[model samples]
Target: MSASTPHRPVRADAERNVARILEAAKVVLAEDPTASLERIADEAGLARATVHRRFASRKALLEALVAQLNEQYLRALHEAKVDSAPPLIALHRVTELVMEIKFSHRLVMDVVTAGTPARWSYLSAEVRERAELLFARLHASGAITAAHPSWCLKIYLAILDEVHHLPAGAPELASCADEVTARTTLQVTTVLGALGGAPLPH
Candidate 1:
C-alpha cells in the first residue's frame, strides 16, 4: 500500500497511532539520517511491529511525511489568500507562513529528500507554479522590482534557504510565537530588499 494514499478508512485509533509514528519518525530521522523503524517505534512508544504495520518500510514513511508537508505548503498559500489579498500583504503573509512551516520541518525535510518519489515531484511543481503566479502578481503591482517576475521567485526561495540555515539555536527561533514572528519579519524584510521591493508597511 502506498503510504501517501491509504485505500481503506482508518479507524480513530489507527489515525492516532499514525500521527504518533510520523512525529517520532521526524524526530528520530532528523537526528540520525539512517535511523531505523525500530528506533522510530521506540521514540513513539509503540512496538516495532506496530510501526511496521502502519508503514511497511522507511521509504513509505518518508512518502507519508512528504505528503503531509505538501498539504501544509498548500495550506499556507491558501491562508495567505495569495490570489485575493493586496499584492504586498499577500507576499508578506505568504512569506511568514511558509517560513514558519519550513523552519519547523527542516529536520524532517532532510530525510524526505533522500529519495524523491513521483508524487513529491508533482506536488512540488504545483507549489512552485503557485509561487510563480504570486510573483507575477507582485511584479505587476510594483511590490517587487526584479527585472523578470521569475527573479522574485528565485530570490524568495534563496532567502528561505538562508533562513533555514540560520544557527539552530538562534534567538529568533526560540520556542515562542513572538520569536517566530520576529524571524518571519526578518525573512520578509530580507526578501523584499533582495528583490528591490519597498519595505512592508508597519
Candidate 2:
C-alpha cells in the first residue's frame, strides 16, 4: 500500500479563527439553530467566506460542534477530579461544570442530540460509567442510602437533562449571577436529595 499523507498542523491564526468561529457558533446557534453561516460569520467578526471556507456547510459546522462538546465533557470530568475528590464534593463540582456547558450550548445540544443521537450516546455512556462509580463511592461514604448507585446516577442525569430544557436566553436567569448560582444550588440539592444524600450546607 502507498504511504498515507500525514495531516499538517494548523497555523496559529487558523487555529485561532477556528476557535473563534466555534465559540460564535455556540452563542448564535444556542439562540437559533436555524442561524445562517453569514450570521455566524458576523457574530465571529470574520468574513463570510472565511467561515464557509472553514466549515463548508451547516451540517459540517454542527459536526464540529458535536466534536467540541465531546471534548468539553471529557475535560469537565477530568477537571472535576471525580475519581479522587470526596463523593459529595465531586458530585457538586461535576454538576456545576456540566450545567455551565449545557446552559451555553442548549440549542446546539438539542439539535445534535435529535439529529445525531449516536454521537452523544458515546459520551453519555462514558459519563454514566464515571458518574455511577461516583455514586458508588457516595453510597459507601453513606451519602446515599436508599437507592442503588445505578439508580442514583439515573436521577442525577435526569436532573441535568431537565436543566438543559430550561430557558437558555431568559434575561432574568441569564443576566443575574445570583440566579445562576441559585439554580445550580437547587440542582445539586435536588440530585443529592433524590439520591438520598444529606444536603451540603450553602
User: What TM-score do all the candidates reach, one by one?
Assistant: 0.78, 0.71
After best superposition, candidate 2 residue 82: deviation in angstroms?
1.1
lDDT of 2 by residue, 147-181 (tens): 57777866776776765556655542445555456
lDDT, residue 73, candidate 2: 79
Candidate 1: worst-modelled 10 consecutive residues by lDDT: 114-123
**Which lDDT values do the candidates have, in the order given?**
0.79, 0.76
Which pairs, if any, clash in model 1? Answer: none
lDDT of candidate 1 over 1-202, digit per residue (tens): 5874564456767999999999999899999999999999999999899999999999899889888888898898889888888878888888778778877887877678666542235257767777778878877888778767556776776677677677755765645556556667777888878887888877
The clash tally of candidate 1 reads 0
Candidate 2 lDDT at 119 equals 35
Q: By lDDT, who's the top model here?
A: 1
